[model samples]
Target: MTTSTKQRPEPMSVRRRTPAWAKAVIALVAVLAVLFAGLRLSVLPGLRDLFGMDTHDRSGPVLLRSIQDMSRYEAASGTFQVVVDLERDSKYLPSAIRGTRTLYVGAGTVDAYVDLGRVGRQDVTVDADRTSATLRLPHAALGKPTLDPDRSYAVSKQRGLLDRIGDLFSDNPNSERAVQKLAVRHIGEAAKESELTARAETNTTAMLDGLLKSLGFKEVKVSYGT
Candidate 1:
């Protein structure tokens, strides 16, 4: 009866449980590491805040902006121009096909109204002859402000009101460098980058197609204005 009774303990070996495909491969590696950390922390800053100020880049699909003539306005009296033409299509997104003071064309007024007893107004200006491509007007100050119905004075002593407020702020830096250069040139022409451009150079198919060819109505055909 000595050690023979201890053999009963060998029948107690029952340790089995823990494999449902190894707990489904550890829950599929913790759901692919929580989907790659939610695509590196919330989908890359929501796409850089709807894409803007990424500095832009297209390398060379064409981007040129080299106009000049800005020296304290070179003697400002209204005739400071630096224009060009050629834009099959543009609506702003990241522009620079050209800049540095653009107004391709504007500030054109040829109004002539007079009658001393009341109504009075005179103006005729169209400037921009960047070395000669034609476009400079004033016709000798429109013939020295014609309206001589027995002149006595009141044309603000020959165009005054501080010279019409310095000719209406002298084209305010050429219409604010042509709207900050057409809003930095089409900011990518769309698809993103904060989209908001395409004023298409003051609508009407480019300002009434260069103002109906400077009113000569050069084969008119521009109706866009939305």
Candidate 2:
């Protein structure tokens, strides 16, 4: 029988099946990756827009704007701090229902401007020799004061037991708005007393005087309307 006894092939080891949990984990990982990719793509446009990345330098004006803003005076008022006491009581038993007191502080700014666009043909007169010029302008007026909502805040709030109990059920939404209004009123009054109009007038005169001199006029005169 000689040397060659047929050698039987070693039995092939059976491949182990993957565990259910392991397969599930792999599937979950794949699903999460896909979802994450989709979410990133979804917010890409918003991110780009927020950062102004979608804009280009191709500039064009579709229409010529006639009106212009010549902001001559920027009058900022001093901070106004006040405490407001608010009371809302039952019509019959006024003392039984107590109220709240709030301390509010606010600041604002007012602007004064001259609109050159409003000047009429007759408003400007150039002397025959072109050595003198006169310009008539409108009177300086106060702009609406804008309350800085960010800087304005409620310093403190004092609420009675009754008020607290009532607040649990309903909230007073108008309190903050009321505070802002009060601050704006005080700022407006303060700005009116700041002589901003006179400052604006002086600035306007100086500005025109320089402009006329630059244009070779020996004498320049500026007048304001009532």
Q: How accurate locally, in lDDT, is each candidate?
A: 0.32, 0.71
Give per-residue CA lDDT, model 2, range 1-226, as digits (tens).
5697898999999999999999999998787557434454346667655655455678886797698756444322233443444434455544534665677777677766666667889999999999999999888777887887777777786654466556656766335776677777777787778777777777888988988899899999999996
Can you list the residue pairs that collide in candidate 2? Answer: none
Instruction: Indicate the worst ten consecutive residues by lDDT in candidate 2.
Output: 73-82
lDDT of 1 by residue, 98-217 (tens): 112222421221112111122113222233532212221121111011122232111111222333235446755223343334332332221122211122212323543475477654
Q: Which segments of candidate 1 are over 4 A away from where they belong?
A: 1-6, 25-27, 34-58, 64-226
Q: What TM-scores do the predictions have? A: 0.17, 0.58
Superposition error at 94 for model 2 (Å): 6.2
Deviation from native of the Cα of residue 195 in model 2, angstroms: 0.2
lDDT of 1 at 171: 54
Regions more than 4 Å wrong, model 2:
1-96, 170-175
